[model samples]
Target: MRGFDTILVVDWSAAEGVRRAERDSIWIGAVRDGMAEKPRPMPTRREAETWLADRIGSEIAAGRRVMAAFDFPFGYPAGFAEAVTGASDPLRLWDWLAERIEDDARGRNNRFEVAADLNRLFPGTGPFWGKPHRDRFPDIPYHGRSRDGHGMAEKRACEVASGASSSVWQLFFNPTVGSQALMGLPMLSRLRRIEGLAVWPFEPVDDAPAVLAEIWPGLIEQAVRGREGIRDMQQVARLAWAFSRLSTAELTDMMDVDAPEEGWILGAGHGPRLTELAMTAPDPMADPPPAARAPLEPPPLSNDCFALPPGVHWTPVDEALDLLRARLSPVAGRETVPAVGADGRILAADAVARRANPPGANSAVDGYGFAHEATGAGPQHLPLIAGRAAAGAPLAGAVPRGQAVRILTGALIPEGVDTVVLEEDTRTDGTAIAFNGPVKRGANTRRAGEDVDAGAVLLPAGHALRPADLALLAATGVAEVEVFRRLRVGVLSTGDELGAPGVDPDPAVTYDANRPMLLALAARWGHEPVDLGHCADDRDALRAVLDGAGTDVIVTSGGASAGDEDHVSALLGETGSLAAWRIALKPGRPLALGIWKGRPVFGVPGNPVAAFTCALIFARPALSLLAGGGWRAPLAMTVPAGFAKRKKAGRREFLRARLRDGRAEVFASEGSGRISGLAWAEGFVELPDGPAEIAPGDPVRFLPYAGFGL
Candidate 1:
């Protein structure tokens, strides 16, 4: 599909009303054409609205598609939407919340009161729980055990697939998505009126210019962690990059998902596949020399190339990557190119020296050359010889013993001249040169094969060529080298609300951001990046772009999860090729995976932060293998925790953080919508699958940006 041209990832906050906390507030990140934009910190819900409106308006003005993904739940479980709004359309719930949510600029709102009232809609504790322990209400409870008679499922299907995600009924504590949903749904309701904006799985996925979806940052957080800045900022940036690298086909597959009522997190289930591919992939170094390999082999083509594991839920991030490695392989062809043009290319075979470096013995200094003598360490002199030996012009006759000849650097050593003195150490005379030393035999002269022997291994296969490597190739008489062709990784942003950066600004639209950042990232990592541009939400338009892309893979932002029977969803259904890979992680659950026209496509949330994180954690390594660079596993280091934190069990989480005083300090908020936290973070502090209560000075694992090649 044409996919999304821009990605905007948001991390939402619910710190207001009864309590006015201000740690991790609203954060918005934008990625245009594979390039990440500066994250914006929204201090208030009102300011966040204006910021979104203006940015989205600009994107719409420029005719780009935008996918704006919020970290909070886009909708409650199936029955809750209907119960609250008396309508099947969850968007109606947005309207309901908008009418009742009383919010202001100073982080004050009546969310608790509204939630309490909503809880009263049904008999007995109608499911709103996790309120503050000290604050009590007629129906709301501080603990789930205190509630009763709630008919709806406590956790949505997406949450169940996420393994250990908190129930939506839980409004506070333990990384629940409910509190933010209470605070953010109203904003979504207001923004719904923006031109071309459509709620995913609630409207035609491809019919609109802008698509709104839910996102979870945790999926990629585990693979590509950070701790240099606030945890929130880094995840969004990383997530944005991840989505921007997906192919049009991949995006289409993601858009073909079936989550209708309860929303799904973007890029969740796909992490395992990426991890698998990176971990189990055959080493690029194992490839035979280009001359010894068979002809180019094509990748497998099938409707189910991206099939998600059936009946599997709660997959860890590492497991997801492992699956991907099992399913994918190098997709590029081998070709020969001049050694000089091979820089930045992945070698298809080991490189061997054709000839020894320095070819033969030569002079190492510009001075008089003479036979060495076993004399004492004192002044010595030799009579002048016949002619000078300059580089590319060696003296024709051999030098006699006790006689000397002037030799320039790189000049071939004259026969019988075993040593040469430095010009600085010799006294120049008309017929003779003098130096104070007992010159050692064979000194100041290079010997044959001194640097490298003929037919020696110069470089291993799969090694990415660099300038220094070229020097070795040149010295070894290697004029041509075989390398794998660059992988064509493409990106597209969906939604009508996206436009070029300088369009007329509105408070509801966003400018293009994801495409630019992703393309640059691919290029930096030595892959051929293709900009597929923006496509409207219409499935036909997206299909047209997909057919013309001619890329090996495409990444899409937005439209991963569409409304009930959305056009894009139907399109995928008709092809019977779309699958949702649901992973067990916070911030991410079901990721889009699919195939179209033999090209692999993956869809990522338009949220810049989530998209970027997914790209690094999953897409980067996958592309590395596809581009014949082999699988890439990001490096991580053990570090100390600078702050205290309590994390729930059954899921892994990567918190954006910065290293301070040799310890990891996590972001103030866990909201995935907060892109500012990502910007502030340098790496992530990875928490294990089991529950953990970390205190100050405790051990932790930190994944830096450099580790992921960021």
Candidate 2:
């Protein structure tokens, strides 16, 4: 008993002969007293337009609120083209004017001018300008224009319909056209035939009766209870009764299957059943229980434990980062060094200003000045005095009452003087000065301690030396500063297969790119890079070289994998300790993070591309953390895909890509091991572990080079 009571179906075809064609007619069906009904068919557009106007006008006159749903775009007016393109052509006119109006409103901030322009271009006395509403629809869809316009109109209608006045001027449109218009505007909320309900890019059409019945109940309830004054309550009741024949909830169950977890609720009447279901089949979408991780234990450092292969120990990424940070702790002790000119740096100890920036009161301009009390309100020519004060020059003494002193910029103002009259603004009378303008107290004066008060914090610890800092330190009379000692990093390119530049590479060896890259990176980070000669394949030799390198950190390449030839892990076990050797990421999975002789060391993969990727992802962040700088997450942007692809789940992957037309297109060769792939890529497209496959036109997250520590 939930079907529409009154349904008016109107066929909006142009010819009456076409209206007779049942298939082409737009029907408006109504049930109880024009409450709700199915749509009827109308063949002619003229008939449909007349019927729609009459339906809207009648509903307004009867004081019965009607929600008129239209198939065409209602927000954009027909004359909107002239407003958007600034072009006037009858042939290019659209049936809807809302889109153009919205564009105009957004593009111009002057509402008065916009309204005037719209009025002049689209002049009509009808509900929608003088032109027929259907003639205003756009011929071609502008990107997001239709959708944006519809959303704006819907918000306005909903607000008025639910406002304090209970206004009856509410209108609704389904973006779907059918015979339902005949039921009049009252049936606006009853029409529920929408296509692709669960999928995106929804298309609107007259849904089947079976599907309509499922949505009819909600539509009827919303219409009757949502608005006041129904023209035909009896018809609505009958329609509702007919709709009850089908179980509306069962057919629409899929629509609510993936409803968001936040707004979901179980019926109070079915509490017991809900409880049983909750206990038997827990929802995966529900919140999960928090996991309690085991406390970390420091690696054992006994003489026996360092004998050969060290036992494997697992640590969380955060904990491992913390350990590395503590090992590479910044120098706390500070030593004062002579600060000369622009060479002054911030002291480790907080410094207070020994004196004010200006040292004393000063004159900000060159002029004849005197105390306000000394010069009366009436015009008087004061005798010219011959006292001079320049920057750093102390004033000889205060000028007598009617006498004025000459002052210059940055020169300390004499005592008992409050105002200064510019030399050009006065006519000197020999030994006396005459001023026509009135003078105010404290004018043209720079007070002592105005810029920096005495004993104020001039510079703080850990602040880098800058030009301004040096000037302020000089002004404060500080001769030296104390700063934290810079860290020294040892760069080692491991493996017999690697060779330094300038040296001729053997037929079987490759030039070591890691050494130069690491050297430049360490220098950029304010750390001194000490290159340790490459280690040979022999494990004992590698261990000896690592132990002898006297550096805060030892960054090496290769010899970290489980292969017998990879001897860096064994060397670390013999020297210090090995932390983690593998990570849950692509391209750089074979990364080795460890410590050597109390110094942090990173063993990157042998592949040049893999080595750089690992450095960007893990090594850079670890270094920043060790330098007392917090870790910074990379920036992510949502972009559309220019191509389609399917990816495996469980492991996150980064694809090299270039952005074009606001869409990201993957590079031809994105193999992680290929150095050319990394070189050609403008940025990386990060794909998370999920079952969703990417399709062309689908939105994706793009990670630019700056976002990934580049």
Candidate 3:
């Protein structure tokens, strides 16, 4: 039913050196056309990357769609992207780390040092910790747990869900998994960027032909019910064999989970469901949803006033973005415009070079043109040619023997000339030029097609054009460009107590903050923000405004929570669909995600602080998706706390704070209604997903408002 025809599974490792006999070397297993292939093992990570690339490329060439799963977390904790790369996009984090990590074909590596470098970027000791080998890194510990002077001692959501999966920060400790993440992520980054390969949950569905997701071998181990295998390769083979045997319907359902940012483990809660569905054959005539499909039905809502809705699960912040990402499809309208006028537009299709980079051999430097062998090994003088060749002009005849042409930079090399002598190295008279240096053949010239070959892709779809990219388009002779239509976002505000900012205020009313803020933010991010204006708690008035707005997506700032005045929920329940509400977040718990009249509707909390937080955390990424730019997690950095604080367990919290003298200082109050707190604070310091006490120097994740496009 789906497109995938070949499935590849990798049991990844971070061990260094030739590991042919080592038990932890990388192992690869594949399934094609119901056949289980023998698992292959590689002694080094380099060889493993090469092998998988070749195999996947070959399968694609044969007209078979492939699904590749690797055993590693595709992303770090949510704030990681903003802190490390100063961008909210998670893929940028991958590219940043990939550029820094060095992997050789041999087994040698510096994974420990890499982890230490990453840890140093945060405040205090971590977000990443546990270094058992050396005491060189003062922030990291040589044990599994964090001490009073260190970071939080907890696992990520997916790690805890796996039951037996190790923490990604444990490097060289009791359970050493830190190396795998530090080393493996770089390779995963390389794999994700492959032309036709797409990394699952992170890359938008339209980015690639095949999807790559995270896999946990423990899921297979459970599926087989602890079947014994002589070696890890044998175990991998068993896993691949099991995957190959699943029916198309079962496999499709298993991979249908919403996992946009923090990837879902395939066969994870659905092992039993898959087994049950496998017995029923899929109808060939009924077309199934494509890969990376969104949930079709709204999850049930709970009747409780302030708690989570019934059957509505509270996903991790990053995982929630993934869900929103699935429901969003890029806007389809496109326009062709002159390349010079397409500066900040998203490319609607790939741009290919029509001609080669250098139509012929051209000089790289300004020098005398001559054949190197024509002169002896020592410095020699040659007669000056009759003509001079400038960058745009060329000499019509070839250089004669014992003669050289006076050439300028970028000029095509004359026939019979293989090298160029620098003008500074030669003394030229009226008829003769004296060479003062030994000349090398084939030097100072750029060969044809050296920079860019004809028919090569210069840019891909969804690329936002930059100044340099415009220059490149000019160089490629691209006169007209195709780009996606600009996204039109509608901003709505609902509350009886709110008034417009510019007008004279009523005695009992507050100036409407959410609409103006969201409008300014949308405009700043290059979207056309349509102000749908404000409505009281009246549902009919809200519906009237929404009907007339006629924008691609809608964002409302009040009436999303569980109060009698919360008409946004009632309206959506009557005429639209409500997907989720009451996320497990502090100051922003009462958020809602749904669809209205076939368009996505995001409901922000009534309190200005919560409204701002929800808009930044949720609405921003959703709009980015519709703009064809894909999802981006807000950037978060680890900074030391300048003040002490304690919070209850279970709920994630964001404390408005300012960075001062290398530490994050929280605002005096935690009330969500304080509008000045949002103004006074430069960013937010995030508490973990449980009860925690923060000392004056504890490391807290600092999320700058700028990272969210505020």
Best-matching candidate per TM-score: 3
Model 3, 568-678: lDDT tens digits are 877776754665466778888767766666666788887888988888877777777667655555667888899999888877898899999999998999988888999
The list of candidate 1 runs beyond 4 A from truth reads 1-293, 301-305, 373-380, 423-430, 433-438, 496-504, 562-576
Question: lDDT tens string, model 2, 1-710?
Answer: 11211223222221123344444455343322222222334444434444544444332222122222232111122333445356542112222222232212112222122233434443231111111233442321122223223211222222232231211112222222111211221122222222111110011112211111111212233323433322123223323333223233531332232212111111212223223322332122232222112111223223232122245343333333334433433322245576663242323443557788778888888887787777666686777677577787857877777678777888888876777777677776566767775677777887787666566546433344567777887787777665544446777777777776758857676878777777776666555678886877888788788889987667887887878888887766554455445554566666565666566778888777777766665666555434323232345788999878787765456777778988999878657556677667777787765545899989888878766535
Quantify all predictions' global Cα lDDT against the true fold.
Answer: 0.74, 0.48, 0.71
Ranked by lDDT from best down, the candidates are 1, 3, 2
TM-score of each candidate?
A: 0.55, 0.47, 0.60
**In model 2, which range of ten residues has the least summed lDDT?**
195-204
Question: Runs in model 3 with CA error above 4 Å?
Answer: 1-310, 313-315, 358-360
| Residue 391 alpha-carbon offset, candidate 2, angstroms | 1.8
Best by lDDT: 1
Residues 240-272 of candidate 1 have per-residue lDDT tens digits of 656666777876676676777777766556766
Query: What 10-residue stretch in candidate 1 is worst by lDDT?
Result: 280-289
